[model samples]
Target chain A: MSADAESRWPAVARDYVQAIADTKLLLGQRYGEWMLKGPNLEDDISGASNGQDEIGQVRQLFRLLEKQGVDRDWLETDREPAEYANAQPLDEEAEAWPTFMVQVALSDRAAWLLLDAIRHEDFTGMVQKMGEDEYFHLEHHDARLETLAVDQPEAVEAALERYFPGILAFIGPATYGAGEDPLVEADFTDRAVAEIRGAFREHYVDLFAGTDVTVPALTDDVPDPDEWDEKRRRSGDGHIDQRVADQLQGVTNREYVIE
Target chain B: MSANTAGTGTAGFSIGPEEDADEFEQELWATVDEVPDPHIPVSLVDMAMIYDIEVDAGEVTVTMTYPCMGCPAYDMIQDDVRAVLRTVRGVTDVTIEVTWDPVWSKDMLTDRAREELRDAGIGL
Candidate 1:
């Protein structure tokens, strides 16, 4: 790689790490909502453990970002929500537990595919380390899904209809520029959206195979890019979405303002 | 005078193997195993958290320990055990004695419990 390309590499890595970390932190916070309220004791315990795993992954990724001289507060502090580049699909709201479970199953499965691809990428050690954590998370979520599907089939079906579209949105746009301004420059060797979607679809099909739950078809086309941008902008107060903000209200019971 | 002094009464208690008492003791213990561990959500029997169960007449006592001394869920687990035991057919009253004498070790976990922990990525 040329000097310019080499210079670009760290930036690439930083952007990729930031985006992934943001996604993990956001989803982890969302999952944590189920800690005490899951439909059953087993599901509650599993959800808590899964949330812990995601937090662990976030911590590791944040540490790497810190080494790159990113301010710790930028990663940890409640910031303007618009800066959170988490894919919109993962951002959809679910009004019930079943819908929430479906949302989690789909998003977590997609995340596994994305992480697996990045893990094998020719990159610095940080991505690889983060990859290991994602593997554990993937397994954890999948196990919970299996338990739910076998033990409570009706709930799984209900969730699939309510949240599957959100899962599709989570794979993100077919082309970064096709939707919102590319949050970060696409750097991975496997940059094609179709390829990524196909991989995600394969995993989804296999997960639901032989089960009563029917895998919902992916949305035929990406949401209009302009509409997506408008949705993104209207998402919430500066750093996190309204839904998350509402969920996390009084989280620490202290007002936080960046100096 | 010596005869008069020997006339002072002596008090003694007699003890024997009470079969019903033994049966009750075993029954009480069997009930304790049905209680689930709050943190792991597994039966106390499977987790081996129930170290001993003793019964004396109507009063049942259980000796138990948690996965660790500072386990945050210790109180909840104790409450769960008490609740479960209170529902047993014969248990009139229940008491749990939380102890640290034989500290809980991973070795105490059943094969299935170990597998669950491993599946969760928690290494022993």
Candidate 2:
């Protein structure tokens, strides 16, 4: 066999990709929930577009994972809540617009950092294509959060205090599995977890300052690794809510395939 | 970039000098250019998704990109590429490779594609 074919691509590689895919899939569903309930007509429209974009990225990763024998269909529609690898905040709907923007600012940045770290890997090509979209998503939320910072400072602060720590878990455990660091060793991502977390802090701190929102201090933002499931790279349990899942699927009507 | 017609199937393609490869490449590009982006109704060529193309005798290879990372039309686009290219003569095999470098953007769209988007009410 050629060197590339003979190479024993590690199962960890596939697991990491699967984790990324699951995260995007769930994140999309969570965003989709806000399509109607967002603060205004424009927020609703933005939510719908961002939700669809995230799901589209999920479809791409699932297709890639399928080459490694993963079933794309099952990954999309059939999985227990705990089985999903998405960060904890996405497990539940955003309690409010500020909460939603908090997830967007931190959770979306986590995804972007992972993509940035993994850009050099052979299999990350599809994920990299998502950078442009992710950038837009971040900017979209940042703007919304900035507006909230001025109009509803109390709401924005409350959400930061509540969700920032859980959002930190979105970075995954600093180390995972028996000294097997797939993030580095498998070329899945170039940076160490600490480095990523640091960058995350720096990015958000600057973002909050620019938006006139108070940036949460990193000291108080630590995630408890003991609660983290390294395999799934998630900090807490529970999948998407079932009722929300039905709404995301829009199962009642499937008359025509979307163009 | 070189093509040798001496063989058939996967082994049919042969590599040679650079100068001799241009005509074959152009022909293959033209053939696959007919494939359209299912969602947009614009040719993949116009969308700049066909990043690279290689032809060796009866075997043809194409590298393509999606409009976005998780574009739902990915499979359909690839199938269209393979289906269209296979219709070209002296091409018994088809290979489609996906790449993400220089990710797709509005700027990548050809003038014709931009015009179509404009007609469709998408802001430039």
* Model 2 per-residue lDDT tens digits across residues B1-124: 0011111232322222234557767778777767777777677888778777877777887877776665767778888888887887788999887765445556666788889888988777
Q: Deviation in angstroms for A55 in model 1?
A: 1.4
Q: If you superpose only chain B onto the true chain B, what TM-score does each candidate give? A: 0.66, 0.76
Q: Individual DockQ of the candidates?
A: 0.01, 0.22
How well does candidate 2 match the true structure in TM-score terms? 0.75
**What TM-score does chain A of each model score against the native chain A?**
0.69, 0.82
The residue ranges of model 2 lying beyond 4 angstroms of the native Cα positions read: A1-9, A123-128, A174-182, A210-216, A219-222, A244-259, B1-28, B37-42, B53-61, B70-73, B86-95, B102-124
lDDT of 2 at B16: 24
Which window of 10 residues has the lowest lDDT sum in candidate 1 chain A? A229-238
Q: How far is A227's C-alpha from truth in model 2 (Å)? A: 3.7
Kindly report the TM-score of the first chain in candidate 2. Answer: 0.82
Q: Model 1, residue A232: what's the lDDT?
A: 30
lDDT of 1 by residue, A50-88 (tens): 676666566656655675688886667655556665644
Worst 10 residues of 2 chain A by lDDT: A1-10
TM-scores of the candidates in the order shown: 0.52, 0.75
Maximum-DockQ candidate: 2
